[model samples]
Target: MNSSDAVDIATDALVVIAKISAPFLLVVLAIGLIVGLMQSVTQLQEPTLSFVPKLIGAAVVIALAGPWMLDELVGFAHELYQRTPQLLEG
Candidate 1:
């Protein structure tokens, strides 16, 4: 309820966001790098070439780790909910 509590909640939210997004971002980054390298070697500059792989990589990451990400978010929400009474009383 106070500034410190708000800061703590904000920090926790940011951590959860980073944790959930890391996999997808990393996968996309790696895929994009590889695609870029391939394009450089092949001397082909096609926009879709880079776009498709990154998209697929992100989709695959979501498909594989979606449940875990959802669990993380749900856990954070549950924790925040549990702390509601304490926060409100402050």
Candidate 2:
């Protein structure tokens, strides 16, 4: 309802987002680096090489971590719901 409340919600949202995304993002980054180096060494410039591997890597990671991700998201949502009254009162 106030600037402080807005700021609080935004910061919480960002923090949760970072937590949820950091692991998968790190995996993708590492895979991308490895793929890039492989491409550089092999001198095989296939346009689809990067896209397929990265897509598969992300899909696997998301599939493996989906439950944990859901749990964290649900927890964050619950916390936000619980805080709604306090935010509104302010």
Candidate 3:
């Protein structure tokens, strides 16, 4: 494909990646912020304190959103596959 088609495809892939990752990223951000605040208030500067909670939060969010993530990925793959002929012909 030409440059524009390649750029469009790259943009679409990035968007799909962002959409799939946003939930987990957001959860991690929120948890980190909260943990930071708690650490500040309690003056507990344990480096490992945030690890488990963030991990657990990430896991929980992934677990909850796994199906939706899968659906989005599947849809993206399907769309890409459907566009293969046009992409190739470009």
- The number of the candidate with the highest lDDT is 1
As for model 2, its CA RMSD to the true structure in angstroms is 1.3
The residue-level lDDT of candidate 2 at 54 comes to 85
Pitting candidate 1 against candidate 2, the one with the higher lDDT is: 1
Counting clashing residue pairs in each candidate, in order, gives 0, 0, 0
Which 10-residue window of candidate 1 scores lowest in summed lDDT? 47-56
TM-score on alpha carbons, each prediction: 0.96, 0.89, 0.94
Model 2 alpha-carbon drift over 4 Å, by segment: none
Descending-lDDT candidate ranking: 1, 3, 2
Model 3 deviation from the true structure expressed as Cα RMSD, one decimal place: 0.9
Worst 10 residues of 2 by lDDT: 44-53
User: Among these predicted structures, which one has the highest TM-score?
Assistant: 1
What is candidate 3's TM-score against the reference? Answer: 0.94
Query: What tens-digit string does per-residue lDDT give for candidate 2 at 1-90?
Result: 899888988998898899889878988898889998999999988877888888898899899988898998899899989998988787
> What is the C-alpha lDDT profile of model 1 across 1-90, one tens digit per residue?
899999999999999999999998899889988988998999999978888788889889999999999999999999999999999999
Clashes of 2: 0
